[model samples]
Target: MVLHTVNCPPSHPALGQCLRLLAPGDALLLLGDGVYAALAGSRAAAELAASGAALHVLDVDARAAGVLERLADGVSVCDDEGFVALTERYPRQQAWY
Candidate 1:
């Protein structure tokens, strides 16, 4: 399985390309400006929800973006430790800037 970390905004091409490549067992972590895509009711949120990959957003980043409560359904919040755990869980990783 692959673990994908997207550090860019939804408007960036990184997220779209990453989404297309995701499989059912993969995981995706949204950080930095990428957290904006997890905002509830957003098109990006809808797309992410349908991606089939386990979805995660960095807790600190979501809090800094003021989107903790507004995060879309099915998206889990992860701390720094959780990030490290994800890296350990998956053998491969793709960083989307």
Candidate 2:
């Protein structure tokens, strides 16, 4: 399984590519502007939910954007240390900008 970090917003071509190529065993972490994709009622969030990959959002980023309370269901919040842990859990990582 690969750990995928998306640092851009959903409207970016990179995000669309990332979602298209993601496999069921992959994990997705939203950081930077990517955190906006997890906000409730977003079509991006719905797409993530359907991907069948584990979804995570950086807590610091989410809070900064004021979207922490609106995170989509099944999206887990994690801290800086947790990001490190994710890198450890998945031997391979793909950063989608």
Candidate 3:
């Protein structure tokens, strides 16, 4: 599985590029400034869901962005330990920040 961290706006070209390359076994970890993409009803969230890849948002970042309650369905909120677990499960990591 590939781990992707998107720390920019959803409309950014990087997001689209990443989505295009995402496979079923891939996972995305929305952290740092990337937590904004977790907002419900967003195009980015929709794109992510459509990719059929696992989606995760850092709980701390979500809370900081004030989007913790607005997260899209099927998106998991993860802590540091969960992040570590994800890295362990996914051998490749791609940071978009």
Candidate 4:
């Protein structure tokens, strides 16, 4: 399975393209401005919640973006260590900037 990292916002094509290509066993990480999608009650958050991929948000970025506390229920929070862990866990990675 692939680990997909999206560094753009939900309104960007990167997020939508990433979502469309995600496999059930893939993992998706939202970082940088992409963390905006983790906000609860958002249309993007709803779509993300329904996705089959494991969802994660970089906590540092979320905090930096000021959306840490407002993240959707199913979005897992992860630190830099966790970011490295995900990279190590998945042999292959795809990044969208």
The runs of at least 3 residues in candidate 1 whose Cα sits more than 4 Å from the true structure, single-residue gaps closed, are none
Candidate 4 regions off by >4 Å?
none
Candidate 4's residue-wise lDDT over 28-58, tens digit each? 9999999999899999888887888899999
Q: What does the lDDT come to for candidate 2?
A: 0.95
Q: Would you estimate the TM-scores of all the predictions?
A: 0.97, 0.97, 0.93, 0.95
How far is 76's C-alpha from truth in model 2 (Å)?
Answer: 0.0
lDDT against the true structure, per candidate, is: 0.94, 0.95, 0.88, 0.91
Predicted structure with the largest lDDT when compared to the true one: 2
* Backbone clash pairs in model 3 (N, Cα, C under 3 Å; residues 3+ apart or in different chains), count: 0
Better-scoring candidate (TM-score), 2 or 4: 2
Q: Name model 3 segments beyond 4 Å from true.
A: none
Q: In candidate 4, how many clashes are counted?
A: 0
lDDT, residue 57, model 1: 97
Please list all clashing residue pairs in model 1, or write none if there are none.
Answer: none
Instruction: Give each prediction's root-mean-square deviation over alpha carbons.
Output: 0.6, 0.6, 1.0, 0.8
Q: On a 0 to 100 scale, what is the lDDT of residue 41 in model 2? A: 91
Better lDDT candidate (3, 4): 4
Model 1: ten consecutive residues of lowest lDDT: 14-23
lDDT of 2 by residue, 1-97 (tens): 9999999988999999989988998999999999999999999999999999999999999999988989999999999999999999999999999
